[model samples]
Target chain A: MKTFPILLKTELKLSLRGMDMLIFALCMPVVMVLILGAVFGDRPAYDGASHTFLAQSFGAVSAIAICAGGVMGLPLVLSDYRGKKILKRFWVTPTSPAMLIAVQLTIYALYAFASLALVSLTATLLFGMRLAGSPIAFLGAYLLVMVSMFSIGALVGGLARDGKMAGALASILYFPMLVFSGATLPYEVMPPLMQRIADALPLTQGIKLLKAASLGLPAEGVALPIAVMAILALVCGGVALRFFRWE
Target chain B: MEYIVEAQGLRKTYGAVQALRGVSLRVQRGEVVGVLGANGAGKSTLIECILGVRKPDAGEIRLLGMHPERERKRLFAQVGVQFQQSAVQERIRVGELCQMTAALYPQTTPAAPLLAQFGLAGKLRQQVSDLSGGERQKLFIVLALLPMPQLVFLDELTTGLDARARRDVWQCLKQQKAQGLTIVLTSHFMDEVEALCDRVLILRHGQTHFEGTVQQAVAATPHQRLEDAYLWLTDDEREDNA
Candidate 1:
């Protein structure tokens, strides 16, 4: 644990040099909020909806970084390290591989939070957006979704056996969630059939939970999303732990 | 005799193939040991088992008077390793890699001087991937020694180096050996073995075929040079195994 801070600082530098997550995870969500505000400025989402289009999207758009970083960035790094035998090299040192992994997780979480703050600030300052939900509840919901997405990433990274397969799996999980999970596209606007399909994606459940929290909707409706996210976290995190390999 | 490494009756099988069978060797403190073998001769498997990266089916092994698996964290602190295929995280700056490595050991020598000794003096901010193969190879050796370890394991230490770079590395290693550092290295380069190793253990088909000093190996075979001696010794085993 004493080595963690240095590891984190170094890993953070590596991530910044790698740059994919910076563009997608740190900067993309803010860009998305600006796009949302510009495209549908101050206009109500639908005829009788209380929220404007940007306001309606505030919660889901905030999760773009999580879906990007947690689902794509985390596993890609894991598989790359595993494939290159970097993980094995690190293992040859006094540091445990778990320490390296924990540092990576912390880096992604830091990026996610930074993205969230930027997205929220953009929406509020540029387009007069405000969170209607309780601040504490909103934070809780955000973290739950982040965990769910990150666990799925871990499972793919642990089980894929190599970098190529992990990259393929990450793309398979990333694109559909980014496109159809109400993160990049609005959930309320999708056709019912499309909605049903999106609901099967974990991020869809996540966005649903986030949307409810952002809108200050009734808590009664969120039980299913909560259960889905929790179960996904437990199962995926457990399986990842069970099968994770250093070499 | 203060053996730094001791392995007895090591055996390992992979499915239908036996990679190591009853292989044993020992190294004393301050001695440089070389392991030489052809492509599929189980040198890697033996080394992996010795390093606790892979477990042997049957063996008792000790390094620095500690079990590799039982006291890994503590053992690793005093031992450095440079694997044949270990390319670290891409795009990581050399200085950062050194910093990250230096942080893991309880005691470490400064990396700048080590890097300088390997011709990478001012390349700290340079990314590792940007280095040439030989440069990367030298960087790894530099990293291995940064821990100021009592012993270091190097596989294919001079594979990518040019003649000058190889000589420079050999000279640097000679200096390390002079400073009471013990080394265990595997190399196909017999000249490297003859230059750096106080003793050589030749493995064939997962078993020790010869164990002796470089001069003894040449004396056993009717060859003038260590390389020719090595080739002549393993040639018969190749035919038998075939």
Candidate 2:
């Protein structure tokens, strides 16, 4: 539709102006890649593991952007617009306010893909990190993980009554996963109890799925994580669609 | 003459409080009609119902000759609106918001000239959050006119503007009415009603208490000024006589 491109461009400009996502979604992943490369360059992931620490963590660190954009960037933007009645303004126009949501999703996707590229480039160039799996497989898995993570945000954004509620919900989802899901701090370094706590997180499942695909390891051990991501995507995405409000 | 808007027997209730009690009015093409009301008198509820932003509990309404509820998506293309609580994206520049609003319509007036008309010519790069209240009000008015709409609905159109800015906006809207744009607006300023509205509808207790020319409304009361007449009509002491 004619409205789509204009809305997308406007949203992109607004996001760039805000610079919140740029720092968290775009810059953070690259920073994590750098930190991983510096701290554990050339070290194997664990005894008898097929990939080095940087290579293994590459998959996990790449998900940093996904977590940030999906949990924080997407919901914050949605709830802010709704709370301010910007969504109501668009609703009175010929265009549907769903276009706003679509544009936002597109922007986050752009951020996620750009973040992925930056993370991959930094890891590959700096620490000689390489993806061991099929490039196509990694791409598919990356998108799946991203979408699944975003589904959580969609539900929170759709159902939240206001910005404050959405912020509280997004933070609850974002922090534990960022710290213990192996997206930032190494999953191997967390205490067993903490790992168990992280395992309950949906993003933890996303990181596990990405980890298997990027390492080119057998995905056989990852069936649960894959199912978890797919189910979360379907369920949360369905609930969001059912309940999403324009204002 | 063809009516650009028509509504009858509209009723809406929020819990036990009746917001609209069978209110109705119609606007002919090229006429500027003002809805005058005290607080909680259902002026906004009526507008929102007609525009399909809120559904009436019971009513028949048409906007732009189309059923507002069923054909809202198609009907809204021809109507421009400015709400009192309007807040655009805080981080967006003035020009960007205008461009975005323009993009939503099939036909549009150039944003620069509209911005210039509102004394916002040099504010293209300024963020919306940084604008003064009057500037923001003017900006929204500019946006409401951006689509070159055949009909415009503005609620509390001059609420925050100073006398000069209000007069400037009145002059601009008068030109638009001269160009055959129909307008339905609500205002507390009788001077604004006198300047722009050809007729006025006064609301009391969620019902259409009076509908006629400004002169007719004024003649109904002993007061010479429109504001005094408004106060007289809406005064609680006069309720028993009416």
lDDT string for model 1 (A77-171, tens) is: 89888888878877678887888888889999999999889988889998999888888999999999999889999888877888889999999
Q: Ignoring the other chain, what TM-score does chain B have in each prediction?
A: 0.96, 0.95
lDDT of 1 by residue, B140-175 (tens): 888899889999999988986788778878988999
Who wins the DockQ comparison?
A: 2
TM-score of chain B of 2: 0.95
> Every model's DockQ, to 2 decimals?
0.75, 0.82
Docking class of 2: high
TM-score of each: 0.97, 0.97
Across B29-51, the per-residue lDDT of candidate 2 in tens digits comes to 99999999998999989999988
Q: How big an interface RMSD has model 2?
A: 1.0
Candidates in order have lDDT scores of 0.90, 0.88
**Model 1: DockQ vs. true structure:** 0.75
TM-score of 1: 0.97
Q: Residue A144 of model 2: what lDDT?
A: 94
Residue pairs clashing, model 1: none
lDDT, residue A105, candidate 1? 90
